[model samples]
Target: MTEVFENSASFASDLDSKDELQSFRREFSIPQKNGKSVLYFTGNSLGLQPVRARKLVEEELAKWAQYGVDGHFEGGRPWFTYHEHAKKGLSVLVGARESEVVAMNNLTSNLHLMMVSFFRPTKSRFKIIMEAGAFPSDQYAVESQLKFHGLDPEQALIEISPREGEFTLRNKDILQVIEEHGNETALVLMSGIQYYTGQKFNIKAITEMAHQKGAVAGFDLAHAIGNIKMNLHDDQVDFAVWCSYKYLNSGPGGVSGVFVHERHGDNPGLPRFAGWWGHDQDSRFLMQKGFKPMPGADGWQLSNVNILGTAAHLAALNIVLDAGWQKLLDKSRNLTAYLQYLLADLGKTFNDFKVITPEKPDERGCQLSLFFYRNGREVFDFLTENGVVADWREHPLNETSERAGVIRIAPVPLYNTYQDVFQFSRLLKLALEKEHERITE
Candidate 1:
């Protein structure tokens, strides 16, 4: 049976009262305004910090102080294997074997490493296909990789874009591009969920299509990880990478992670930029190095793990693992749906904005990106002034000079309650009405 959603504070409070994971909200330190918790909704940008994160970092500091260099091997959570602490949680979240996942490197750096092994561009198959408006960092990485291979991006890059009048790309269109360029495509790298539109691409289907075209398939999960449940192992994704600061609630620039399918993880002969830490553990101290990599994703590490950063991540990871990944996803869908329903209802009488994120729960996550047709900047500023911590962007609409402002609101299930969503809708309605009055007067 379809659940009927109502736009009322009492209804929202009732939903919050019944939420099984409501207790988890106390685990985070929500930002304050006017001596009350702000309507925090930017989890897609930077997640609220976990209450335990500070102590986790301090513990690592104390360990370093006591053990000195010996901390590498002598501490409770030794720095030598600090990255290992994250594997269990990372594996469960991304749906890969622990051996196939590793906590290491930033998102784009890992992307370059994966490309080194997977994007072996040949004379006939040299084109790299991707979404046109991928995050700029990914775009720069792909462009540089092509140039490094002496291939001009104009000739070697295929960027699939949304169709006319559409804000998101169609799956059929994406598949069609892969098939059409099957002979020439060497790699297909895409965002698991679009950063701007909040559209969750079909990782399994995209991987299947890339394989059909004899091209390597990989994803940047910076926006998808911790926000959505993935089955990358069963889906046979070649590799993937993501940062932990957003949905994972780790601090800013926290250590990122990578997933290499068992197929590639087992292959040590794969070409990659090597480093000392990536060497086989048993022989790492021998220092007479031929550079034998640790098998699986651990083989990709380029430096001694950043103990402090990984500690903060593990602190946050503990909360999600306790909450259960599936349970968090369940609440995420409902929170996004309630917000969507309420916003759509408001649109009936006040039609100034459009929700551009995919309507299907399966095709999106907790985020809803609003494309304002009028009074966008004013309304967004008003929300910010009123303590709605949201994200604002002016993204390209199509292959034209025109662009539109987007306000992204992500209600993270771990720390956000239904009452928070209710309060946001209330603020949004007031912002809109106030803006309308100011313009008319």
Candidate 2:
């Protein structure tokens, strides 16, 4: 039975009072204005910093000062093996074996690195398949990879798009496209959760489809990593990459990671752009002439670990772990659903309001992409000014129309509260009415 929702502050506060994970909010440093914390909902973009990030970063700095270059081997947490520290944390998040994941370059760079090893195109099978509107960085990476192989992107790339009148792709359509182009497809790359629409693709289904077609399957899990749980290992994902800045609360442009299936990760002969750091650890410092790759995802490391960046990442990862993965998952589903219910109730009064993100919890993560037919930007700005932290994106209806815009709101479970969604509902109602009056006047 569905519980009745009351659009009241008391109702929301009561939910918070019953929340077992409410104490986790203190782990993050929430952004504030005029001495009050803003109602943060953009964790899908840049998450709030973990409170321990500063201290962890300072500790690394102290190690550097006290040990100088010796810090690489002399510190409490040796810089030479710093990236190793995050592997276990990342493994649990992505549902991969510890040996299959490693903290490394930023999101895009990791994509390029993964592609170098996974995207081997043949004359007969040279095509790449991906979601139509993947984040721009992934687009550029695919385009350049195709160009490098002397293949025209237009001819070698297949982008799965939404149906004529839809904002999200159907799983059936995605499978059909993969099947149609299976014979010629070299690889399938898609985001685990689409950034713009907040639709969580069925990674296991997509991976199985791609493999059945004999194509390497990979994913960019930037939005899905911390917002949703997935088993990359059991899903048989060939390779994947993600950034820690979003949902993971790892700070802006935080360190990224890659997941290489154990089947592929154990193969030292697999072609990859090698760096000294990726060489066998025991002999890495011996200045080996030949490349001897480390087993698993560590073989893909391009350079020595960034101790400072990994410090922040590990600090954030610890918080997520301490919060308990299943507990956070449960809270995310509940929080996003509560907000969804309230938004739906509030939207009943505004004919122009529409939600483009999928309504099913199983089809989406924690985000809701809201569309406004008119004064979208004005209302977005109004909400921003009134302490609602959300994201804005232009989704024009036509070339001549500016009225169609969207606000991407992500109520991250780690620190966001039921009270945050309650307050947002109230603010949105006012913004809609105020904008309507302003337009009429």
Candidate 3:
């Protein structure tokens, strides 16, 4: 039988002592509050910065100062191939071959590029399927794609929502909808993990279903790439796009990544918006008349790599690679499970607070979304004032009958420790108590 966890400071300290990755906490510069490290639980929004990021970026700056234009080729780590240094590490993180992955443009930009090539809707199959309430960027991208193709979004876009009274969608229902609309649907685009609920979708199963239905499978993995283990190649996911600023710990507005399956990546006949950087390497500087795309995902590039951003990414990826994927995942699972246990324990004292995130381990990632019966915003404000850094999502009152909000807490394994989880639980309990006293008085 497994040992039961105790809700005590000593227990948290013991767990920290036994943690294999405990030393990694020192590698990141944690934000301070009242002369102490703030309890940060918002890696899903923006990850903490790695200490080595400054050194890596400065090296490129020095090269730029000394070599100027020659920095493209003369530097030790030439800007010409700067992105390549990070590709191997990123591919390992997303479970793709190096050639299939490229560190490039922002998330939405890559999504647009992928849709241009994959969302080729004919008159017969003009519909696009996606989750209801997907991240707004995806909604806009799909709507614009339909408009760009001279189709009406109201007629061509299909959104699959949860059953009445349910907070999350079921896999069976999603597959059924795909099967029913297979003939008319041209694309199936969804998030690997829903941002609001922190619910992890079955990517492999969904991809297989889309392929069987003759539609292309693509994912916006902004919340999934570093948070969960994915097998995009084996899952046969046609393409994927993710931003690096979240769980990957790159700086804010960092470069993003894209994955195009080998089948489509190597095909020179595939249509894409082209530029000089994407041309054949040998003839790249030949001032060539014809646009010849390089093989694999690199062929989709429009401009040269952002050297400074790539340096930050390389620094962060090195930490992830050195720690190993499996070890990080194991820690993530345990930390989340511990957080869930604490929340459930706290629920006994506060009947008004409920956890909406899925209870099953495989169904969710590290984030736990909490729904309060009343004064959700007040509680959020209380926590924020008390130095708990978390995210809050409020539903528009006009769109729904009742005003609702969810507090999202993500305890990342790379820098977040057992003590952080314990501190959050303690602070949350105090905040709820204070709020309850205010309401009753």
Candidate 4:
């Protein structure tokens, strides 16, 4: 049997004292409340900025100032190949070859671009399959893509949802849907980690199932890239896209990344929206009419690199790389496990408190979604007012049901500590107690 953890501040302090990555906490500038750093637990929404990000961005700004238009080739890092500096680091994060990855446009934009090449619809196989409650942007992108092909989204979009009264989708159910719609499904685009429920999907299995069904498989790793371990190439996923602003520690609206399996990278006949930057480096400046795309994922680029955004991403990737991916993932698993344990302890005191996120560590990353039976908004307000920085989502599982509100706490391994998790648990307990008293009064 496993040992039970005590719900005590001293126990949390003990855990912190033994943590190897505790020093990483000082590397970020934590938000302050009442002269103290707030208990920030929303890294899943927007990661805390790395202290080195400003220095990296300022370096690019200095290059632009010193070299003017010549910064393209003259600067130390050089604007011409700035995105390359981030490729190696991002490749390790997404588990792909450097040639297969490129830091480029934002997440939704990259998704659209990938869809241009991958979402080939025909009368026989013209449907797109996706998770029912995907982020709004993904939903909109798929709908628009269908319409662009002169297909009605209502007829061509297939959504696989959780069974009634369930908060998360079962893997078997998802696979069964793919089997049922195999013939008509043109694409299978789903999140590696479902953002709202903090559920991590089996990417390799899903990709295999999609392939078996004669459907192209891709993923939106907006919540998965930095939060979990992925092997996109080994998984045989056709393409994947992710944003850097969340767990990646890049600034808000930072440049995103894409992965095109090597199999698809060299196909000259693949359809894509082309631009000058994606032209062969040797012949790019020749100003030739016919487009010759560079090999690999870079061939999909629509414009020159976003220098400032790339700089910020480079800095953040450096931090992650320095810490080591395996080490970070190990810490992330433990940190989230500790948070879940504490939340369960709190649930013992508050009958209304429920954890909707999966109980198994392998099924989740660093986030836990807490569902309150009542006073959900009021409790969220209390946590905010008390200096606990978390996120709340009003997710309506179905049209006929009331909104299912949840408070999401992500104990990011890069900065958050065991003590932070303990503090959040304490605050949450107090908030629930207060809510209970107010109701009884």
Question: Where in model 1 is the C-alpha error above 4 Å?
Answer: 398-403
- Model 2 Cα lDDT, one tens digit per residue, 1-441: 126777889988999998999998999888898899999999999999888999999998998889999888886788989998898789999999999999988999999989899999999999999999889899999999999999999999999989897889999999999999999999999999998889999999999999999999999999999989899999999999999999888888889999999999999999999998889999987885999999999999989877888999999999988889999999899888899999999878987678889999999999999987767899899999999899898873344556677899999988999899999989999998998899789
lDDT by residue (1-441, candidate 3, tens digit) is 114788888988888889999888887999999998888999999999999999999999999999999999997799887878988888998899999999998999999999989999998998999999899999999999999999999999989988887778999998998998989999999999999888899999889999998999999999998899999999999999999999999989999999999999999999999988888888898896999999999999989989998899999999998888888898999888888889999998898678878998899888899976567888889889889999888853224524368899999999999899999999899998997899789
Candidate 1 TM-score, C-alpha based: 0.98
Instruction: Give Cα distance to truth, residue 170, candidate 2, Å.
Output: 0.3
Q: Model 2 reaches what TM-score against the true structure? A: 0.98
Question: Candidate 2, overall lDDT?
Answer: 0.91
* Total clashing pairs for each candidate: 0, 0, 0, 0
To one decimal, what is the Cα RMSD in angstroms of model 2 from the true structure?
1.3
Error (Å) of candidate 1 at residue 411 is 0.7
User: For candidate 4, lDDT tens digit of each residue in 1-441?
Assistant: 114677889988988898888888887889999999999999999999999999999998998898899999996798888889988888999999999999998899999999999999999999999999999999999999999999999899999989887889999999999999989999999999999899999899999999999999999999998999999989999999999999999989999999999999989679999988888989898898999999999899989978988888999999998888899899898878788888887767678767888898889888899876566888999999999999888866744434348899999999999899999988888988898889899
> In model 1, where is the ten-residue run with the lowest total lDDT?
395-404
lDDT of 4: 0.90
Deviation from native of the Cα of residue 183 in model 2, angstroms: 0.4
